[model samples]
Structures are given as structure tokens and as C-alpha cells.
Target: MVKPANKPQRLSLSSLKADFSSAVSRRRLVYLLCTFFVIYALCYQWQFLVSLGLGPDNIHHMTVGLIPAVGAVVLSLALYWRHLCIASVVPTALIAVSWIVTGPYLSYITLIQQNTVYLNNMYDIYVGLYLFAILFCLNMAARQFLNRKISAAIMTAVQFAAFFIIALQWVYFALYHSCITTSGALLIFQTGPAETLEYFHSLGVGRIVFIALFVALLIGGLLFANYTQKTLPRTPVYRKILPLLSLLIIFPSVGALGEEIFPQAFPIRTFIDTHDYMERSALYAENHDGKFAALQAVQLNPSESPNTVVVVIGESETRTLMHAFNPNHVENTPWLTSMKEDSDFTLFSNAYSCVWYTVPVLERALTEANFYNNKEFNSSISILDMAKKAGYKTYWFSNQGSIGVADTPITLVAKTADVSEWVDQELKQSTMDGALLQFLQRVDPNEKNFVVLHLMGSHIEYRNRYPKEFQVFNDGTVNQQADFDNTVLYTDWVLSQIFEYAKENLNLDAMIYFSDHGSDPDKGRQPDDISFKVLRIPMFCYLSEGYQARNPEVVEAVKQNKDKFFTNDLAYEFVCGILNMQSPNYDPTYSIASLQWKMERKDLVTRFGKVSLLEDTEF
Candidate 1:
């Protein structure tokens, strides 16, 4: 490619006008602007509709979700519109804009690139591509019809086929994913591919009905288009405005709004479907007293304390696969195995999470809440309050969804710790640990500290939770085993790094790590399904050298006490044994530290049918 010598070019307003007119004709501009504007408004309103069904920041989530869809639809339409008229460059440029907006970008670079791979993959599920194909054909058909180049019947067939395919995806998603009392099937659909197929296979009558209805809609849309054409108004504006407005208003409202509002009235559906998802959370509050009293031991006891206590709340960690719990499995817990041996640690062979999700488990464990249904407990006194009462500084950190819920406990935890950090999904995973480390550094060395770190851990779509470098499966073969192994390894590495920080930086007395609940390893159940794996978690304590020396008895007690423990026992056991605090809710029967009742057996089962090896006998 040789560079030509600079050629003088004439510059004039007339030349610019001619170029602009050629690039974008007035008729095309009207159609494009009308289509895009209508689409934008409908999508924006649909976003709001979807948010209405959800709690708290439903608006924020729906907004993030709509970004890709809206961009893709607008761009796809523009591309088709230009391609229909045989205008090349302008359509291509519009497509490029859509791709860049929806795709990944390097923050530091000016080289604007789009992720075609992502778009290509999305074509199958997204309805926008189908819509583009339909409209392009329709536009072509309309042009031909006006020019007398094609028969009405042939054009009608194309319109009908396009309408059917495009409409089906939305209908399917709505019928299946809508959060309504009647559409629990949507839960099955949204879960993933296997579940959706399975549900389809099982639906004998429903499948037939859906097929029939789909055909009806297809025939209806085609007839409507054909009838409108025969009665073609003299004004093009009527043709332009009617179909666009109808689609813009109907598709999103019926799809998004209907799906969200469907389940709003159902209390059971809304209540149990939460981060705190134990079936009978309210019962614990009903039957139990002194919900916040158990923290007395952890807060009041001077012998167990030197400086800091970190309560790292994990999500969905199970003991069956944890190498520490299952010594037979070498890879199950390679990191924890090394950590336990390297650091002077005490491992409880039997420890179970009381509830499965973060909110209920954390709220119940930290606060004076007995159960998950007890919304009043969200504002109640908690372990943070106990630490505040004990004059110890407290801090809470998390990497979870629900920014509103994240702040609830953190506010209380901050009142006690003098400093707290609540990290949500907004921050990058790599940046989170650094932010926490800085918070730890900023705290005064003179004050006793209570720091809590909540992690996403091995949650579903496990691949996304961890960085790629930690992914051990090289063949691109993904399954439950690979996902589990990768998650365990990444989490183990994270734990080790945090432990290293504890070792080198803070003069910590003890670092206790436990999960909120366990997840099903079978991959046969829902993510929220209660199983042994869901309750079983890696619960252990790492005692710093400085604190161990000062609290010899506490260390001895930890060394000796190796029985099964339920998280419900934490407030009682840790408080009585470590913090040396006293409370009436500190029942000897439920307390892990109560030697007198250590022989008693109890059935540690949650309302969601999750049971674990807990207690000496059924309680």
C-alpha cells in the first residue's frame, strides 16, 4: 500500500449536503428513528416492569440486563434496514456501535473493539436477531409489493414465519421464566438447559397446548399483516406508526411486566425465595429466646482475646467433599489440608450450617434472630452489638448481591467495630481482598477488633466466581466435579491468602471460618436444594502465636473440644468458652461447650429437608 501525495480537495457546504443526503435519506431516517425510539421506550419501560416483581434494587438489576438486549435489537434492525436498501457502510457502522456498547472493552485502550464471539453465541437465545431477519424480509416484501414484483401470498408466508419465530422465544421465556404463582415452571426454564429440556419432556398436555397456541399466534400475526396490506392506507405514516407502536408496547409489557408482577401477591413464594431460604426460619424465633444472648461468651471473655477476631462467612460449603472432613479425598481440600498442618488449627469433625443462604444464616447467627421468616430480626441486636458492648472494634465485608441487604448487617457491625467495609458484586473479585486488607491496616492497633469477611465461595455458575488462572481443568470439559474442584481450589487459595494476612499483619487472637450453608453436589437438585453438602462446611479456627501464648486455657479448650457442632451452638459455645459471656439463652443442651450435655443426640434438620450429623441424639 503506497501513500499518495496529498491531493487538494474542494470543501463546500453543497458537497457536504450532497454526501449527507446520499448517506441517509429522509424516508429511511424517519423509519429508523421511529423504530429505534419506540424500541428504546418499550425496553426502558419493560426494565421497570421486571424490577417491580423483585425486592429492593430491582431497577438496577433489570437495567444491567437490558443493556445488551436493547443495543443488540437497535443495531440489528439498523443493519437490516440498511442492507434492505443496499446501503453498506452506514449499517455496518451502526452494527459496530451496538457491538462495542454491549461487548467487553479495555479501560486503558483507545482501540475500540467489539466482541463478535459473544454476539454470535447470543444469537440463539436473543429474540432481536430473529426480529431483524423478519423486518428485513418484511421491508423487502413491502418494497416488492409496492413495485408489483412479488405476490401477496408469498410475502405473507415470509412475514408469518418471521413473526412466529421471533414471538416464540419471548413467549417461551415468559411462560417459563415469569415469577408468577401459576408459572413456577419458569423457575425450571431459567435454571439452565438440562432442567428446561427435562420439564419439556415431562409436559405432555402443556407442551401440546403451547404448540397449539404458538401456531395460533403465528397464523394470527400473518393474517393481521396481510389484512393490513390489503387495506393499505394511502398514508405511509399509518403503516409506519401502527406496527412499530403495537410491538413496542405489547412485547415488553406482556413479557417483562407480566413476569415480574405475577408472583408479587404470593407471600410463600416471596418469603422462602430469599438469601435466607430455610423452610421454617420463623419457627426458630417463635420457639427460642435470647437470640442475641449467646454472643456474651465471645464478647465478655478476656482470656480468649488479644486483639482481633475474624468471622469469615462462607456460602454453600459442604463437609462431604471438604478434604478436612473426608481424608480419603486428596484433592477435595488440598489447600485446607496444607493450612491445617501449617497453622496450629483445631478442626471440628462435625459442624453444620443452620440455614443455607447468607441472609438467614448470617442474620440468625449474628443477630438475636431465631428464624428466617422473622423480618423483625433484621433490625434486631446481633453479635456486632455484643462486640460494641465489649468495647471491641467491629468490621463487616462481603461480596454478594443485594446491596440493600448487604448494608443492613454491616450498619450494625460498623456500630460495634468503629470501621466496616461491605463489598458487593460491583467490585472486581481481585480488588476486594486488597480493599479489606487496607481496612485492616487502617484500624488502630490498640483496640480489640472483630472483622467479618463474606465471600461468594463455590456458588453456582462456579466458573464465574473464580479467576481463570485457578481453573485446573484444561480440556474445557465442564461438569459438577470440575466446577467443584475448581471452586474448592480457588476458595482454598483465597483462604490461604487471607490467613497469610492474619499471620503477618494483625495480632489476631483467632480467625474462625464457617459457611452459611452447603450446596448439593449431586448437580441433580436445585442450587438451593438442602442436602448434607449444603450444611457441611469448613469450620475451623486459626490462632495466632501471640494470642495463643496469652490464652493458654482457651487454646487448651479448643484442642480438647472436638465434638460435632451446629452453627446454632456458635453464640452459646463461643460466648461461654471464648468470650466468657453469660446469658439465659446459653442453654447447656444446645451449647457445644457444655460438657454435661455433650453426650446427648439431636437431629439437626432444617425445614428444607437438609439434615447433617449433629448432636449426640435427636433434639
Candidate 2:
């Protein structure tokens, strides 16, 4: 025994090599590399992921990133590593492509705008992993019925289709500086062939060439992968059934959670929403006559004197940033600031929008429907309807889109006017709000008129909302707040132009201006992350000498209520009071121009009546 122990076996070079090789085989090494690449590529847009608390500052990044990676690695280790590795490529590539296309905008939203709502959720990464698993299952399922050639072709087609959607989103963002939304998708149906061609032409040759090259590269890569990759052996029956079950049941169940958890599916979700919106619009249009028939019975007692009333709707103009509203801010609204001293002007200090978004806010503001009234929006009579019934020549001049697919809910109200005009007929052009002046000039203001001018004021992509001449806040550099300030300045100039024109050219009796909604450019206007700045809109009324003389009590009432809490949903009633058009539906309690008008800070609710402004401490 002693003699045997003297020759104790040592680890030889061959045995050591075998042990090391067992620990990390070539396949396992490749798998590890693939997993690393995916995690790295996904997190390359650091601001997006980091905002979700999945960065170096925390351990969330490691936990979240490793879960999906470990899951994929384990599946590969248990099954065919080659098949799993190949399947992972498609989703990884798609993620990379999506990041490349949307990275700048995501960065802008998170870093520049300080809005983390766009891509800051950890659910985004989960969505990507779910998509990866789906692609893997699809690959496995395709192998069961189709030959290698057919399966490869199908997979490549799927890849191409997903890539096409990404390309379309890129094109949309390039044109609008925003992603394709449900409203935006509906806008495509509203576009004619000429407008579509014009849009593409506007993209110019450089962008067109770049898009073509991108498509070519994508096709070439997919083709190379299809031709060069070897087919895996047929799996057992249970494996085939498992993939089918995952594809048909598990993947769809996860996808059904909707866009909040899976924003990567926005394209498909947008299309579905657009379809539903179109259907609703069509139904509303078909029932338009019946919906308004009740308005015919409601008589409007008009004033004896001929008058002109102007309603100017501003977009995303937050009083928190306007000098006229916030004295501590920059003097961006010089005209409004100057108007503050005018006896004719009455600036409302505590005005809030009914909702934080344009469409919903405008829907309530333009119609008799309101949060407290519990009136159905579709059945509610619009200001245009009231004006028309009162024998006033109503006109709607908007710089925004008119019709999309069918008449949008807003467009339905606009169409009720005797004359409706839009600056951008195609809905793709980024014309200045000043373009609306031409339409104003065409109006015969000598007649008793009810005019509504919809300005594209202070919307997103604030830089595009104004010309270079209005870029007074910036010094040839990118500054989101500066750009927004410039928009505010341009909007002030626009308001002055409109007021001067109406005063000089038209028999302007009374003018009212209020924004459909406000915005928190730093935090975004999403309902989930709303702030008081996103609801605190600027509102004011201008009375002509003629109007003040005829309606002295109304003017006094408006001036007295300037500091009272007001919501734009009561705009319909207020406009009626200004017009001196009395009707059974008119409620003096809600009209800011009436002495009976009353609202308390605690009673005010915004964000479509979900959040109380008084409780929103963020103000």
C-alpha cells in the first residue's frame, strides 16, 4: 500500500485539457457570446433602459438582463443549441434595428425632455424577450410541416415584414418627429395618391437612397442566412407540440397584455386601433343627422345687434411657462404681456383644461358635454350647431387636419360649421400657424360671424412649429426648453396678428382664446404621468368697445371671475353668454361670462376626469 501511494496519480496535460474542454465546449461558448451580444445591443440606448432603474447604479439591470439570457441558454442547453442559436438571431436583429431607428427619439424623450414614460419601463425588455421566444417557437413549428427551403423562406418573410414596419415607423418619425399613432395611421387613409407622392418627394433623394440601401442590406443578410444555414434534425413529437402550444397559447396570452407592457408591438396595435376608430367614425357620420336633430328644437334667442365672435383654440400652451401667466418666466409672450394692461383684455389666471390631450379636451370644450354634466359626447350639441341655429354665419379655420380615414370626432364638429377650411389639406405638411391668416383674410367679417381659428401652437417638435426668425431662445444649438420658449413667442406673435387683423378688417365684437390642453414638456403629457403644468392652460377674453357698451354686465362678470377656478369644458356655455344667445341648455352656473358662474379649486378634475387638480401636488 505504501509503495502504491508513492506513485499518486497527478493531473496529466491530456486530462486537464479534457476537464477544461468539458466546462466550456465550443457550442456553449458561442451561446454565451450570443447572449452577451443581445444584452449589450438592447441596452446600447442606455438612457431608455437606465431610466427604468436597470443600469449600473442598480442591480436591476443584471437581474432583468440575465433572466431572459439564462432562460434562452437553458433552453439551448436542453434542446438543440444550434436551432436555438439560429432562432435567437432574428429577434436580436430586430431589437437592434428598432434601437437604431428609434434611439435618438428615445434619448430625446428621456434625456432632453426628461420624460421617461416612452421607453423607461422594464416591461419593454420583457416584451423583447417574449418576442424572442415567439420567434424561436415559430421557427420550430415551421420545421414540422415545411421543407428546409420553405421554412427558411417563411421565416425570412416574417423577418422582412417586421423590418418593413420598422422602416415605416422611421419614415413617419422623419416626417412628423413623432411615432405613428392610431390617429396618425388614420391620417394615412385620409391621404390621397398625390399627397403621398408629395410626402415621398419631400423626403428628398438622400433619404430615399438611404432607405433603399437599408432595405437592400436587410434583404441580402436574410438571404445569406437562409442559404448558408444548415437544417437541424427533426425533433420528437412532444417538442413539436410544445412549440405549437407556446405559439398559439402562451405567446398570444402575453401579447394580449397590450401596449403598456409591449410597446414594440405598437405598429400592429396602432393599425388595430385605427381600424376601430374608422368604424366608430363611420357610424357616427352615418348617424350625424339624427344626432343633431334635437338641436333644431332648442331655440337660440340672438342679440338684436349684428356682432362677430372669434374663438381661438391654442394647442399645448401651458400658462406655467408663459410670461403673461407666470411673471417670473421669460418674456416670450410679449403681445399677451402687453395686452394684460388693456382694459378690453381679461386674462383668466386659474384656467385648466378638461383633459391633458387635444382630441378629448377639444371634444368637451367645443360641445355642451362636460365632466360634471354626465352628458354623452356624441349627443351633445356643439358651439357650431348653436351658432348655425342662431342665424350666425359660422366658420371653422384650422391649421390641423380635417378628415382622417373618415371624419374624426373633432372633424365631425368642425364640419357642422357653415364654412370649414384647413391649412394643410394633406395633413403631412408642417405649415406655420401663421398660414391660417390667409383663411382669416378670406372671411367676410361684415356679416354676423361665429369664427373659430384653430392654431397649431406649441405642439411637440416645438422647433418645427416656428420659423428660424422665431428661434430667439437658442444660439444655434439643441435646447428643448429653448425651442419650446421660441414656440411660445411665435404663438404670441400669431395671436397679435389675428387680433390686429380682426380689429382693423372685421367688425370684431368679442374674441376669446383658450388652449385645448397644456403640456409639461419636461415630464410629457401622458395621463399616467400628468402634472398640473399639463392641465394649467392660458385663457383670456378680449371685448371690443362696441361689445363692452352693449354687454357691460358680461364684461364685468368676466373681469371679476378672472381669478376664479375655470375649466375649458364650460367654454361652450361661456361662448353662448358672450354671444348673448340664450337657450334652454345654457347653464349660467358654468359660464365664466355670467355673474352666476362658480367653480371651486377642489371641484376641478382633469385628465378626462380621472385626477383631481387640487390633489395633484406636483403643481
Candidate 3:
């Protein structure tokens, strides 16, 4: 038999109040707390820049930056007024997109303000814009799909979750981006509103601030829940102001479409446009299909075939800090100094990076004259392609990320090479010399090979970028001198090691090395920091003793033309002097190693759409 069950009495108001007071809903408090905190922090920090008065140049960015905060506040208020507790996905999606699209330009503020800022070349600007837009779209989609919450508990949990993830990201960026204030500011700004909380963390005050904000949000959330229970109508004040909010959003959209969207989406034919060149020129170059009326290359045939010629394309390696290139710097390059003493090596003292950035110069330098056209050539004709056509084994080894997983120029360059190797994925980490070892092991001593090594060289995140074990300077933090010399020394050591391995294992003939472009380490100057150290890089053609002994004329020619050769002239002179091919446009005056040649044309655009031959004397 079953016993009859007795029902318990309903709880009293007193008991309910006691329970609520003892255990406040931690989750509900977090969202309301964080929401106001972010709003207050952004306005407070950016007040100085706001006071200076933003202008036409940055009006678009300022608009982009301001809208998200305004939207968030409006949406939150609307939900509260409607007696609603949860936010819909649509408003969240709008917030995410607005936040991300504005991401690329976040750094523009600091870039304009920084004294040491280097203006991105015209080509770099276009590339960066395209890249940033695509990345923003992808990130927005991911965030939209990933963050879903229909409950107050879940939304509060999201606040805490987002805070920690963003904090971790900022910490890594700060450490890597140490001392480079402009770069650091840009990085933090892109990471979004939450990073201000983390910036306070870096200052050791984040915990107290976060906790105080957390408590405030709890009180706000409780008040919101209580108000929603009453089913209160939205105040008339909001209804009257709705027209203003609508206008604010619609006006910006219309203006953006007119100013930026239309021209970028549909450009008319122009004789010279950098964006057009980036989009279509690669195709024209590959097929030799463009009106390339401006340039040509002459080929050089070797008297005796050599086993291998290796070219190292170093990144951000500048002469300003290199002792071998500038006497004022301390002796930081013992290996390079010794290499310079060797009779077979020809060093050019006056070499400069034609462009301030990497990819444009990389495309221009390696692609010969064809790189400067406006056709849609997704595939490129690099030196590796030419070498492969000439029946030599061509290889490309790089430490740079494959800008895209598929259909990117870097990948195309790799595929065109007979053998291509890219070491880093997600561009996690790399060094110049480490990327080179990929090729050294595979090359056969008996085969004729042409290998190009693209190094990370002295790229930013200057301190952790190089291995700590390899660090020679004890300044405890990174400076231009220590960071650069450490990187240079590491690169020098790697080159020396590679050279030794080649000497022992292969019948190597020559090695040519140069940087894609140099760096302006002085933090507050423009790109043309006239100090020779910034523009200068070491360019050397080192011939093996056996090769020099076997082919003295080639060695003598290099010595004679060392001073006159520009990187632009290298492809034409090299192809004519070593490969022995002839094109109708080939002219030795411009193609040869001697600095005596002049670029005959002046008005034609370079592949990057910059006016080439601005002055004949520039070469």
C-alpha cells in the first residue's frame, strides 16, 4: 500500500527576497555591466583625437568607428522599451559587420598621427584594402554564426567569454608588437572595443575595473528584468527621435555608395591605374599579350654551365643598421665582412629598395618586364618560369604565408617553379635562414639548378621574431639597433651555413642576394629617412673559387658593373648575360650590370602604376 503524500506550502515573499539577496544572478549582471563599460571607455580614450576635429581624409573611418557604439545603445534601449529580454540575430549581424568593415582603417588614425609612420605606397594601399575587406567579410560571417544566445543567462556568459578571448589575443599582439606604438595601436584597434579592457590589464588595473563594471551590469540587468515584467510602453521621446536615427544610418550608406562603392566596383579605362594593373596585368604578362611598349630584357649565356645559382630575396634588411654597408654602425656582421674580402664576391654599396613595401617589389623584381601591364594574368611568369623554360631545375622556397590558400599570386609563383616549398602556415612564425634549408637538402650536386629563397629577414614583431637563444643584445627589450643587428646576424649566420654546405656538397657557381625593400627604423620619420642606413642593403654576387677560376670573364664583368646595376636591371642583364636569349626590346645599356645605362622611357607606368623613369638620373 502507498502512503498519501502531503503538499508543501508556497514560499513567502520574505524567503524569496532572502534567496535573491544571497545569490544574485552573476550571469545577468555581466552583460549590462560590460555594455556601459565599453561605451564609457571608448568615448573617454578617443576624446583627444575627437577634440582635434576629424576631417575629410578620415571622415569615413570616424563614421565607421562611431556607428557601432551608437547602434548597440539604441538596440539595447529598444528591446528594453518593448518589454523584451533577448536580442535578435539581425541586429547582432549588423553590429558585427559594421565593426569588422571598419577594422582595416582603425590604424589609419595612428598612421596619420605617428611621426615615424611610413606611408604605404599606392600599390600597397590597394592590396591592403582588398585583403582587409575579404578578411573582414570572412570574420563577420564566422562571428555571426558562432555567437547565438536566446536567454539572459547565455548572453551574460557571452560577455565573460568574449572578454577572455579578446584579452588573450591582445596580450599576444602587445608582446609581439612591443615598442612599435603605431603598429601596436593599429593592432589593438582592430581587435575591437573589448581590448580597451585589456589595455587596462596591461597597466595592471584591469581586474578592479572589470569587477566594478561587472557589478554595475548586474544591477542594470535586474532593473531591466523588473521593468520588462511591468510591460511598459516605449517612451514618446524615442518615437520622436527615430527619424534622426534612420537618417544617420541611411545618409552614410548613400554617401559611401557614391564616394567609394561605385568607382571601386566599376572603373573606366585609364591609361594608367594601379588598381587595374594589380587586377589584370598578371594575365597580360603571362601571355605576352599587353601593349608592353615600354620595356625589354637581354639574356646572357654562360660560357660554361655551372651547377647552381641561388638568389636570396631578403625582407626588411636595411643598410642603415648593417655594419658591412655603413661604417658608422658597430661591427655586427663578421661573416659578411669576411665574405666581402673574398675576391670572387662583388658587393654593390649603393643598392636601395625601389619600393617601401615587399609584395610589389617582389612581383616587379622577379617577373622581369612583363610584370608591368594591365591584363588579368592570375598566373605569373617569374624568373623560375624562365629558368624552367631554359631547361634548368627551378625551385622557390619561402617563409611568407601563402596570402591565400588558392589562386593567390604567391601560390602561383610557387606552382610555376619546378619545385616550390612554403614553410609557414597561417604565417605562425619563421626566420630567413630557416626557410632556406628546405632547398639545400634536395639539390643534387651534379644537376644544374636555379633556386630562389624568400626570407622573413627582419620583418616586425622584431623581438620574439628571432629565437631568444640567438639573441645577442642584452638591452632586455627591443630597439632598432639591437633588433635589426640580431636579425641580420642570424641571417648572416644562416647564409654562411648554407654557403658552407654548398661548398662541401655541390659544384655551386654563384649566389646573388638582395632585399625586396628596406625599413625606416626611426619611429617618427617618413619613408625617405635620408640617412643611408634606411635605404641601403647589401647586394652581392659571390662566385665559387672554382667558378671564378673557370670563368674569369663573367667575374670581371660583375666587378666592372657592380656600381651601375639596379635590381630593375638585374633580370634583363642576367637573362642576356647568363641564359643567352634575345628579345627585340633587349638593350644592353639598360640590361647590363653597369650603372651607365638610362631608362629610355619616362611617362609609362611601372607595373604598380607608379610613373616609371620619373627622372633619368634616378637610376
lDDT of every model, 2 decimals: 0.49, 0.69, 0.49
Tens digits of per-residue lDDT for model 2, 454-503: 88788765665787899889744342577778989999999999899988
The TM-score of predicted model 1 comes to: 0.53
Measured by TM-score, the strongest candidate is 2
lDDT of prediction 3: 0.49
| Shift in Å, residue 604, candidate 2 | 4.4
When summed lDDT is taken over every stretch of 10 residues in candidate 2, the lowest stretch is 110-119
- On lDDT, the candidate that comes out on top is 2
**Model 3: per-residue Cα lDDT over 5-99, one tens digit each:** 98898999999998886565454455556654664355434432322222222333344544444344433333333233343332233333333
User: 116-216, model 1: which lDDT tens digit per residue?
Assistant: 00001121212332233334334433543363324345555655553442344345435543212112322433468887667667777886688778778
2 or 3: which has the higher lDDT?
2
Question: Model 3, residue 480: displacement in angstroms?
Answer: 4.1
Output the better candidate (2/3) by TM-score. 2
| Structural similarity to truth (TM-score) of each candidate | 0.53, 0.71, 0.56
